[model samples]
Target: MANAGQKNRLVAVHLDESIGRGPPDIEHERAVAIFDLIDENSFAPVGKEEGPYKLNLAIAERRLIFDIRKEDDTEVMTHILSLSPFRKIVKDYFVICESYYDAIKSGSPRRIEAIDMGRRGVHDEGSRLLQERLQGKIEVDFDTARRLFTLVCVLHWRG
Candidate 1:
């Protein structure tokens, strides 16, 4: 049973195909992130009370786009953010992800755990940055930001 707060969340989410989806692992991460995001999340664009919203996330002209809408597809607002602020963090995240994946295949449990911790640290940093950037535009909790950050990385993937 959902409460009033849960009713203010996203019911659907879409990622632009123009950005191109990543490889298998990346795709898996995107899927899991979206699933978790929809299952439980707190998302509300500032000053907007109508929701159970829909979101279409995309990257265009090197900018990040958040297209928010109502259940009937009525336009709410679209917030576009510069990709510049996320560049370094996103790059660092990818590097750490690659190392973590490789460690899973060849490294011991201790090494794998260590890399996973670093990966989570980088992920948290990106999430915090996202919340800061979206401040005054959208309000999302830490968990929601974390999941959205995963989707951002998915859209940012070039290969």
Candidate 2:
């Protein structure tokens, strides 16, 4: 658990699903598809992009990256990205996982940078509430909320 001011959440996306495996042909078709679904999901974007992404319940931007790791001799490609600066009067502040893309574009893998907050206008009320409720239960802030992408990657395991 993070203190009141400092908290770091790590969401891991590792599974034995078909997508988890590196197919003979690597492409971001699924990722692109998800990106295209974002607008309808309610996410506008901390910055801007071309797509139909599945944004979270809050209004934020959708970023993307591939989470690469090794397990049992198989290299897994998990999409990692985040939405930020979400404000919910009821929830106050919360982040959402926009999408996960496999690192398979041929050539070489790349790193995904974080979204720009200058335009995000992020604020967390629910996080504050939880902070007040616990008085130190968990540290929620820009970084914490920004961690939505990690959560999104591992969310499938919650079930």
The per-candidate count of clashes, in order, stands at: 0, 19
Q: What digit string (tens of lDDT, one per residue) describes model 1 on residues 41-87? A: 88989998669899999999889999999989999999999989999
Write model 2 residue lDDT over 1-159, tens digit each, in one string. Answer: 122121121222222343242322222422432333221122212222322222222111343333433223233333333423212322221222121122122223322122212113322343333233322322234333333322333222221
TM-score of 1: 0.96
Q: Candidate 1: deviation at residue 89, Å? A: 0.5
Strongest candidate by lDDT: 1
Candidate 1, residue 123: how far the Cα is off, in Å: 0.3
* Candidate 2, superposed: residue stretches over 4 Å from native: 1-122, 146-159
Q: Clashes in model 1: which pairs?
A: none
Backbone clash total, candidate 2: 19
lDDT of 2: 0.28
Candidate 1 lDDT? 0.92
